[model samples]
Target: MDRDKEYRDACNQWLADCMLIYHNQVEKIRKKRLAAATEALTLCIKKQKKCVNETIKETIDFDTSYANKPSSVQMNVPKKVLEDLSFHSYIRMSATQLENLVSLTGPEMQKNNCFKKSIGVAQGLLLTLKFLAAGDSIYTVSCQYSIDCETIENIISTACKAIWNQLVLNVMPSDLSKNRWLKMAQEFEEKWDFPHCIGAIDAVHIVMQPSSNESPSKQKSNERNSIVLLAICDANFIFTFVDMGTYGCNGEIFRASQIGCAFENNDMNLPKPSPLNENDTENFPYVLVGDEAFPLKTYLLRPYPQKDCIEVSRLNFNCRLIRAQKTIETCLGILSSRWQIFSKTINMDVDKTMKIVQACVCLHNWLRLSDLSGNSCVRYMTTELVDQKVGDVFVAGSCRKSSERSGAFKDISCVGSNVGSRKAIQIRDSYLHYFNSNETLTRG
Candidate 1:
């Protein structure tokens, strides 16, 4: 009976151990199942959060926000602000003129494409003007205009091309009429007192960076990559002709040679040779005065180099040439001061920079015309007044006495002897005699 009791106890213990192992296995399975469910739920939650964020971003109206913001150009710029001098200083145009430009350029700049959301014509022009007047970077303008960098770049380039295509013909009349040339000549004689002088010729350097792809052989020794702006300005500081994009390595004389082809080919329609004085029988060609950098042509007059010039007559010719050449110097000075873009190096690629420069020249003419039309009180400023001051100093030193004047004419025989042709020398001597005879005339 005792043996039977021990066997029964052992069996009971074995059954209890099996039951405990089963419970532990069930717990392990439950934990694994719970962990898988939790991971699935977490992924769903993340997907829902991403979807909600995207929907919110899509619903936000960038244009509407920009319009309502006081920092924006549309709402921030008031109607009265357009007339203010500060506003004009920023855009370089009066309210009326700006309106006209917007009206003129608006249709072309406006987008009709499917992108439906694009910068407007007026806004684009405003952006371009801001860039030109302030010399601001594209990124800066993009931030101010509330546009993307790509959009700002597109707007500026398109607006500049539009301005050039639309208004350049009207502003820069290439085929000027004979009457117009005569009027220019008359103005030169009246203002600068240089007879038969149509304009003053000069050149300025516009600095730029060479392209990365530029061949090593093409690179200049000085490594200066620049565009030469060869221009001729009338007495009133109007650019009559402009040729740009010549390499800076080429000297001014070589650059002038490039522009003189039109005149040589008779395509320029330069005025016919006429007498310097009304009573004089000897005829003189309508001439463009330049510095010693230019070679003396029948139509182009350069000063006798001071190194070779010993006589007072040569000095007098040089003084007169300097007086006329001041117009171009002053024209370029005013251009740089007003635009301010030219004062610093242009950061654009070569092709775009060329277009912008051409546009600036056109706009300069437009503003000058506006100034003459009673639109703005500020006249197109020039350095001619400073030139006049220098002339005052020169007259005080050189033209004070009759003996000094007599001594100048006495040496006239030696003038232009080494430099110019006989005919050219004779023409210069006639002018020298004319200048000497009219000693009472204003030496402007």
Candidate 2:
């Protein structure tokens, strides 16, 4: 009788175990179904929202957001707000400077405007200045200026065009006379102690975000596209010449440029080679200092490679060239710091980007030249940018940090690796000898 009871108890326990396993399997299946349904519902809602957004975007045309004109934007900014330095100095312009910019660009913006309620001249200038001062999008700018994205676009285009047109001549003249070049050389001599150096040449890469239509490879964050800005700056940290809107290798772009051709052909009306001292017989060209990316030529001087700098003369020559080269980099640093647009990648098309860059360059030169007292530019150019003699060593300025934040002030990676001519080597040696022998030049 006891054995029979034990068998019954075992059967009952076995049946309970099977029932618990079945319940667990059913519960798992039910939970999975619920999760799948929730996922499907969320996807449907996302699709609906996407459809609605697309329809709304279709209703609103980007180019015709204002009135009827493609280039006219209705502005709501007050005149007082536009003129107030405290209000608008986010773009780094003084009140006097802002007024001057408005005056320079006002006429072009006011010409042939049929719209009764169009953007005012000061308003347009402020809007454009805001755009150039940072990497904000048109829509983002629209929110701040109380204007539509499309109208903001037109205002930026019109304002940039006017700025470049009005200030190009006074700031960066396309054609400089021989006397002007000589004056530049003299300034270089006095300030940099670099005799016969009229300007410093270098290329700064302007970072660009590739449009969706461009190759997918370029759209990656790591593989960004860039347009090269090849510039020559004088001793006063002003751009003497600017060639922008070029893509590809820096050396190739420079070689294909008009100024580059002038350098090669000796047709830029640059000062003729002359002896620096009365006793010195070797004539030295008024040259532009450049980095290793640029090829050494009679008209341009690049430093000797580090691998070949076994002699003290080569190192000394490199230091002088580097000292002069700081002019261009410092100019770029100030431009980027003030304009602020160069701190981030430009999202516009190449043509539009070119116009913006040109406009900024002109503005940079205008402010630099107008501040005759040098007080107005003091904040932008502190002692951090100037070279100093630290004991026996000649130390470079620590202002490279200022340029590190700029998108357009960084050096190009793709070098030309160009083999310079024999004449170029002889000229470099001559300059090296001249610097090493002169006690005045050698003492830090």
Report the number of the highest-TM-score candidate.
2
The ten-residue window of minimal lDDT in model 1 covers 407-416
Per-residue lDDT value at 160 in model 2: 86
Q: Which portions of model 2 miss their true places by more than 4 Å?
A: 1-88, 112-118, 218-224, 373-399, 405-410, 414-417, 438-444
- How far residue 368's Cα lies from its native spot in candidate 2, in Å, is 0.5
Q: Candidates' lDDT values, in order?
A: 0.65, 0.73
Task: Name the lDDT of candidate 2.
Answer: 0.73
Q: Model 2, range 12-107, lDDT digits (tens) per residue?
A: 999999999999999999999999999997797445334343223222111122322333454444222323445434655665566666666666
Please provide TM-scores, in order, for all candidate models, with all chains considered together. 0.70, 0.75
* TM-score, cand. 1: 0.70
C-alpha lDDT of candidate 1 relative to the true structure? 0.65
Q: What's the distance in Å from true for residue 292, model 1?
A: 1.7
What clash pairs does model 1 have? none
> Model 1, residue 185: what's the lDDT?
91
